[model samples]
Target: MKRHNAGELPLSAPAGDAKRGLGKEEAAEQGKVDRYGKGRVRWSRLCFLFAVVSTACVVARHCYDAGLGRGNSAAVVRIDAVPGPPRKIIPIARGEPSEEPRHRDPPSPPGDDATSSSSGSDEPDDIDDGAGAASSSKQLPSPSKAAAHGHQQAGHPFARALAAADNKADLCGGQYIYVQELPARFNKDIVQYCDKLSPWTDMCRYTANGGFGPLLRGGKAAFQGAGAGWYDTHEHALDVVFHERIKRYECLTEDASLAAAVFVPVYAGLDVARHLWGNNVSARDELALDLANVLAQRPEWRAMGGRDHFFVAGRTTWDFRRKPGAHAGWGSTLLNLPAVNNMTALVVEASPWHLNDIAIPYSTAFHPASDEDLFFWQDRVRALHRRYLFSFAGLPRPGDAKSIEGRLVDQCKASPACSVMECSTTGPDNKCESPAAVMKLFQSSTFCLLPRGSTDTLRAAFDALLAGCIPVFFHPASAYVQYTWHLPKNHVDYSVYIPEEDVRKNASVEETLRKISPEMVTTMRDNVVGLIPSVTYGDATSRIETTVKDAFDIAVAAVIDKVTKLRRGIVEGRAEEEKLEKYSWKYPLLAQGQKAEDHHEWDPLFN
Candidate 1:
């Protein structure tokens, strides 16, 4: 439970003389003293020197291979902007520093705090000291140096690509996601926010990759596979999708002038979860209110009333929209705030009624590095001689009167052809918690049961698709009404819909599944495989090429496209009247034709 400061190294054991009783702090300080200056050579110092030498060697070798920080020159395109002058596009040699005097916008300054006091007292100290200004500006890191530094942090495979892209134009039709450099308190420092999300359990593991959590076991030979990709499982960790995607977004740029949309990387999901159980309204809403206030002062907000700025949440929109006097309940009234309502909000489970709330894909287990890896897995699943007709992998909710999970569990357990991975029989050996085990079950079955979870959407559906198993849903809201962008226009093509009414009436799920022809099942499975790429989140550690669009690509493109249209509307003075509508008529509502009776209550599923 100890909180460490930013950039502070954790304590390690002492190397020499355990009987000397030297404290860790003393040992660390002693390791830095020169032997010639009133001290003998300490073992710690020698170890430190050795580590420093090894790191330097690795950095040097990497830079050499990358053709960076060397005299060898290449052409690079640079954008030059001066106050009250027309911007010019000029070509310059690599490593050649520009002399036109770099002027950065107020919020874009390096290492600047995202949240500062209104008096502006926390402004960067370097701004006022005229004596060191020019020299300091000249010392600014080049693209090569930045890449080298990025490598040292974690050796992210995309560091080289990031360096190579220094001169490349934004590929998002010139749109870029301007990531806010907020203070640790807003995001990183508060990762311990995980520990307080709920009262009983410690949730620190969910905070990895800025709250994305750890990578999943991608495949049997993921590390050795050709075009191998990264995969991770955040089964209950929905917030991780936004955290990882924002960091890996290709259109991300630090330059404000090139930015079409800005991302406020507030760990809002974690921030609000900690306060949900507490009854105090002010306590639940403190950070959100602060975020709205700080963002309002930014020049970008003043320009468009925050229409171009957005944030993503791992939870549902309802979790943050608790209204006053109506109910003393869980969650904060964040979405109800005036400032946040003006801006867009992407949630894992969006409200069907909210216009600004965009429903994005929940993070699944497969995070492939390349298209080849994805195709390889898809082929493997297609080749699987599935033994089970259908499978269900979930815990039974016996308490809920509306839930059919218990009945499905009973039917699945009783059926000879079904492969059931029951979570209700809790123990250390529960295979349901294991990603590999769950994937194996899905791959062995023709269809994976996806009952309605506490939320409308569940990560299990995405998992089923990733494993090349057709998802069988009982509710239209489960998949048909949600994740329209990543799914086929015709839900019947990729999934099976057994209406809740039929299940409630004790209709046979096994009989329904057995009726489908083998050819039809193969077609449905193929359709599910095709959707793998779109629903999968790529590895955050590397930049891998994929033929099919991934979730990150789709989300970025959608946000930019909507922002562009909205900006255009505003320019024409029709901002208020303009609304972005679903344009998936290209894939007409095949769901309607497939089952007219099921589409009665959920007509939006057709749209």
Candidate 2:
């Protein structure tokens, strides 16, 4: 398959053009005959009346058969069957196409050098997932601008109140979200080739059960029958999980005008996963560029330059913000794209300095199907007897001088109070790979050491919290600065922050943890347990029975609040100047006279 730069690709022709062309030709021939005489004009009039009656009769019959004639206003319309104008294709960072052989073939099947997928899911089609096959031979319908901006007319006051109650919009602070209907390539197609997403492992399993992974047995005893919600969730499945969760968002509105925020459900992390190991920069950035070009043509995107739009990048922000001109860089430049910069990104790990990136928790094994399951597990963890003082459930970083993993591992091994589950570099039997074992390890320990890995944050931190273990962070970037949205503002409220400097200077891990009073530890443990609900992602298939908000709920609410503030700032005309103050959680942490852009030593870890 040939690759074309974003806007260089030629747009597909509209469907049913041949039939329309035939009709125009017939009209032209009739016009010529009508110019002959008055007698011919009368005959034409009679024929036009007959044709109109026949068309009406045919439409009535079709409507009756489809149950639409009985006032079925909710009749599903096949977008392709409806006649409309040709879709407008906007190129990314380019003017009109120059006709330099811009057309390319449809994406090949999975395992080939194909850029995307051509098919969709086997379930019922919905606007949220953008489910449908898109090929060069078929032109998928573009969302109508009018429909996107249209509002539902209010009916009787009492009826309107009843409808509002049914929608439960009040629960979301009157906020509504519109999920953008994107082409299959942007999402579903990427999921179709899930096995090819990662170079190291088959990611197909992670895409199962709405990205929650496989179900685990024995939930009745643990979760009080809410155990059905528990799954062996993969850390990187957030892209698919977030997509599935938002599909069932209670505040979702089909009319964009009523929406407080717009969600673009592109599995961006999965799009770049397959390209991270390869040196081809174009291949790494292709999907991002294509996604940008597609959004550029959207009317919703044109409003406020996508400030109200948000997406989930399941991986760390570093994976998407590749340094320009660095050919051997680690990941793609998805977040760096101009079109993407304006939108909010919900990532597993965020850039402390970037205003658009917001850190969300990684998916842990525990996904509560209901509040009962969530509360039961929280209570179980709180009551469990933590035998070890501290524990480390990670591998050692050998070469990196900045990594504190080596010191932490050595200290944990030397101390009897520390339970070290040393993960091996190569082995299928690695204890860290098992969700049950990892949770048990953390649950048995009072403190879980979260050393900075390849990235500032680790999935283990969230898992530790899930098991009701207090996280011990060596760097502010690991949890303090990254997850301000989910974690407490004061780090001391729920975690222990040991400066990496102190650890390198040979500070005893056991001694530092032992210094804390038993009362203080209990308080911190209680705080950590209370955070289980906010940090945990609930089952996407079901809603929590109570008012407790899970990670998905928190992220959505945060996005709405951020967008609301941003839109207000724009209207006040101080958005550009107040951007850092508005979006940067790190702004208040900057030293006196220090700018938000000032370089920091830990910046390399995120890049």
The candidate that wins on TM-score is 2
Tens digits of lDDT, candidate 1, 128-156: 10110011222223345433433332211
- What candidate 2 gets wrong by more than 4 Å, as runs, is 1-173, 218-227, 572-585, 588-607
Top-scoring candidate (lDDT): 2
Error of 1 at 268 (Å): 1.0
Which residue pairs in candidate 1 collide?
A: 216-231, 216-232, 229-368, 229-369, 230-367, 231-367
Candidate 2, 1-607: lDDT as tens digits: 9988989978765656634656777867856675777688889999999999999999998996676876947664534554232222211111222222322221222232111222233221111211111112223234454223212212111111122222321343235677888999989999898889987777888889999888877534333444566787888889999988887776565534335688998999888888888889899988889988887666455445677789998999989988765677888988888778878998999886687788899998788777777778888889989889999988788888888898888988998899999888655878888777787788889999999888888889988998889999988888878777788877898999888888989988789999999999999999999999999888857663467989988888888777666544433335345555333656645677977678765555444
The number of residue pairs in model 1 that clash at the backbone is: 6
RMSD to the hidden true structure, all candidates: 25.5, 20.9
